[model samples]
Target: MYNKRFIIPGLVIFVLFVTFPLWFNAFSTASPVPKPELPPGGEKECVAPASEMRDRHMVLLNEWRDGVLRDGERDVITVGGKQYRKGLQMACMQCHTSKEKFCDTCHDYTSVNPFCWDCHLTPEEAALKKETH
Candidate 1:
């Protein structure tokens, strides 16, 4: 059949396209992402468990954002039966003082550029901007 001529070449091209990323990554020299260091002051834990916070911090933050901005609710969040105020710059940054070392490590690893920085800045970022100008 005339169609027989195209089938072999088409299958070869299809296989190549499907497996390109695996081949390219095997040849590349990319290093693994480093883990974020804990904050100073020996803070023992987050409002939630380390596993929950690592996986779902963004979901928590988004709920906080909606509560604060849209609903005008400035209430404390209860996690692990402990109450913590619900504001990023006010509460979260109290422990996570270094945004670059703490936040950027995970965010960069996942290729996520959170817009939290669009409105908020770490104490260090504010200081740097003041010094630059």
Candidate 2:
């Protein structure tokens, strides 16, 4: 009688441990189906004019600056919905560096001279001073 009781309890425990995991795995594998893409038969696509893009960019910049000042949140200035944190090299300076390719591309296309050096010193000058010391 003692042996039978122990065996029954052990068998119940073994079945529970083995079957529970398999049942969970089967349930988890039954994922929902994805939805279909929207039909492309719509109105003609409209490209934003250059002036409109510039105006929109200025509005976004103002909104970002306001959020930074008021809320102290860095989610204001986002690219592809990713927030950029404030830091010396991690902020806007990351892309607005003197020798970067992005600056040249805009300058070449717009024929506008970038007056970055008027306020900020060049990176080459900073490096030279560091080397001399």
Candidate 3:
């Protein structure tokens, strides 16, 4: 009602500031999400389909952890006639051998620090250690 000159500009500035991020990004091209490196072996199969693995790999790994540690379900799994041990080191790292190439790219892109390493070594390194010991 009062000070139309000052009040109008102040409201305009506040609105622009609030919407700046949305509008700024709208006019600019966003960086595309990085594609993860595939297995070096060129293996075409995974325990789950590619879509499921992309979206829910963390959940799947968590389930594996709980199943192995809590339920003692350490049995082998068969998929597409291939046998896989019910563990990360034994199954996953066999093909996804490089942590940086296979794991870190996507994990870094999403900015999630998974606690998987707290209790387990990078599975490939663990495998090497086992062989040497």
Candidate 4:
């Protein structure tokens, strides 16, 4: 009778301590995919090939670097005064707010990391806080 009682409790304890953690870990395991590394010798691909879709991404990066637009303001960006809508509604912070989710999605697929983050803030205005403090 004593042997039977001890065997049942030992089996229950072993399942709880060992099997439960293994089951939980299988669902929580993350992918082993590595993040893209920075380029060398001054080679960078900020915009995709010169396509219509890529034009907006280029304009947005250039304008942000030049300090043309203020944060949270809707300034009409007209490339050559033609009123370019491609990049009009987009902001630097839109994708960069969640760097891992938004930026990593495309960057990981393409295997390139843009250097824009080196100098500018995601929201553009937030960089000012770092400077003042």
lDDT of 4 by residue, 6-118 (tens): 89999899888888967776889655565433322233332343354344665556665455445544455443333432231243233234455555666666676777667
Candidate 2, lDDT over the whole model: 0.50
Instruction: Encode model 2's per-residue lDDT on 23-127: one tens digit a residue.
Output: 797777643333322213331211234467345634544555567668786642344444546422234344344433433454455566644545444555667
Worst 10-residue lDDT window for candidate 4 reads 86-95
Q: Least accurate stretch of 10 residues (summed lDDT) in model 3?
A: 30-39
lDDT tens digits by residue: candidate 1, 73-115: 9997664455678988777777778888889887887789999
How accurate locally is residue 124 in candidate 4, as Cα lDDT from 0 to 100? 38
Which lDDT values do the candidates have, in the order given? 0.83, 0.50, 0.85, 0.51
In the predicted model 1, the residue pairs found to clash are: none
Root mean square deviation (Cα) for candidate 1: 3.5
Q: Which residue pairs show backbone clashes in model 4?
A: none
Tens digits of lDDT, candidate 3, 11-101: 9999999999999989998756877778888878899899999899989999999999999989898766778898877788777877778
Candidate 2 regions exceeding 4 Å error are 1-90, 95-100
Error (Å) of candidate 1 at residue 58 is 1.0
**Which regions in candidate 3 have their CA more than 4 angstroms from the true location?**
1-32, 127-133
